[model samples]
Target chain A: MAGSNPGCGTTRTFKYQVRDQFGQVMLVYNMQLWDSIVTTSTNTCNLGGYNTTCAITNTGPCNVGTFADGTFNENLGICAPAGHLVSGGCITGCTTTADQTWNINGISLSGDVKNLSYQCDRSW
Target chain B: MYTLLLATLLLQPIWALPPPPSEQGLQVKLRANLENYTVAAETFPQALTKVAAQFEIPMGIEWIRTSATQREIRRSWRHTTVYGVVESLVKSQSGYDFAIANGVIHVFPKGALMDRSSFLNHRINKFEAKNEFAGVLSYRLRELLKRTISPPLPSSPALGTAGSIATGAGDRRITFRLVNASVRQILDKLSLATDFRIWIVTYPEDRTLTETGFRRVASLYTSSSVADNEQPVWAFLRWGDALPK
Candidate 1:
């Protein structure tokens, strides 16, 4: 690829070869393309137990994927994997406390703000 | 004597306007129907004024006196276009050029509109930017995104089997060595690199369900390669959206 991400940012295409028992190639896929919109942003949250009392107000349709696979848990207060990830980067809709800490996409909100460090232990 | 001649010449009006248009170049846009014009037994200027008054349109066409424009041309057609009258009169009166802009007509001598300065006098032109060629890249990327990301085809030497039953079929995955990999190969690599699903919906006409391999989708949207990357999809949506009119 020319760039780290080459080609138009449309759907990436895949090719497969179909063959009879003798293993000669067959048909090909006609790869057409289309459009999409996905923008993201980030913010700080007071992890006073970010999972519990810490109020991190981000817009909905967001996710905080802070796991090994970068997967996210929905309710930060729950502190458990809800199988969601940060597509939009703000703790998507996990506004447990109301404080107007920041604004995004022209929508203002109030929330507790703080930074926390994370450590991971090797499982395998 | 030279000073007197200079003063006399300086006193004359520069005659900023060109000599009155002789009948040659004429282009006119017919705004209203020809029947709407009331032909009169008068000078060309008077006839033009009558038509302008009847139509209630402000005098958009310039009124310049010339043998061609001033000639007492009579109405020939009972019903026709506004331009039809102008064209007819121009045909009747040789050596005149007629041009119309936004319902305003200016009949001048041939070659009158041809001013050497300004782009309007230059040839019409068209242009496209180098980046617009990104459309080609978009097309190529789309070509790559339509296949099973896995190497699905490789043949292993098989041993003759007993008549009872068959087992362990399709176990070998083919590793392809593409010399000049196509968009398909590039997309195949992308699918391997990412967790995105590249696919096309199949219709029964593509072949019976028993057929192996993807059938091109009938609908253009359903048939082409598409990706899950939301950002690129959005960019593709807005492609060529900002083209100048």
Candidate 2:
């Protein structure tokens, strides 16, 4: 996803991995950064053999899928297709973005990728 | 007479004994001089982050929801100890204090250290990692918490753990062994073991879990702005990246 600067302060786009309880990346989401204000783009994708789009608001939970057997097939990169469906838990994680500049008082110092990365969570 | 002597020895005040090595080491680090540090104006967390980066000290900050901590502060010190700098910073803001534990400088509210309900107070039976990325370690801790604590207590909220580390080659990793340690102690160990010596855990102003019943997950970052948020976030900092250019 692309982020627009709009010539205000600074804007950056970040790639976030939405992982399950086992640290498996279930889906990916892109975020637009405006200074400290962050907004998530609605992403629709095929995950775990289920076609679904997670409704992610600003720093909100991205309910990816509720698999029957509580497992996603690693080989197929989707949920196993042969189990009964069950209620799945919400996927939540930290939504804080990394800033490109560190402002101490009035001074601005450049920042790097090591500053911050996007994160999300999953439960088995 | 020997039994009486033994009884008297056992009755000696705890203060008479020397502090543990970790506490002593922390005390030394706190006494180290901070030369030529100045900030025109910044929030409490901002100033603390700057000082930790400049001094290359392992520091962790846990913030509570309060307006007193949100106010801006200003200070200029030509030469002063880290302890003095931290003391002044804590004094600049109300409803906060500092402590040295597991050889890390931790700043939090006065009673947070003893708050049993805090996630920091949760105990881990065993944690051993070798050359693990700091973010991965954080993920492991979250998994451990879910495995050990959540299933038995169905009413407890599931902790949403997230972390981001520097990708690509040359990323920093850590190795350590901890047995029967609290979440706070593990964080302190991470601070001392990696270049990401600075850690911060923030809380939402509402101080309530979502309707889904999950406590605000702590997000681990390599480096980031000290900006406060309405959501909970846990972040770490690399001293090298935070240095003044």
DockQ, per model, reads 0.01, 0.02
For each candidate in turn, the TM-score is: 0.21, 0.52
Evaluate residue B21 in candidate 2 and report its C-alpha lDDT on the 0 to 100 scale: 35
User: What are the runs in model 2 whose C-alpha is more than 4 Å off?
Assistant: A1-124, B1-26, B34-36, B146-171, B209-233, B240-245
Q: Could you list the chain B TM-scores for each candidate?
A: 0.30, 0.69
lDDT of 2 at A59: 27
Question: How many steric overlaps are in each model, in order?
Answer: 41, 7
For candidate 2, write residues B102-165 as lDDT tens digits.
Answer: 7788898778788765667777888887655444465456545544333324554322212221
Lowest lDDT 10-residue stretch of candidate 2 chain B:
B1-10
lDDT of 2 by residue, A1-124 (tens): 1221121111131222223335454332221111121113311111111111111112211211111222111000011111211134213222223322211112222332123322222332
Docking model 1 quality class: incorrect
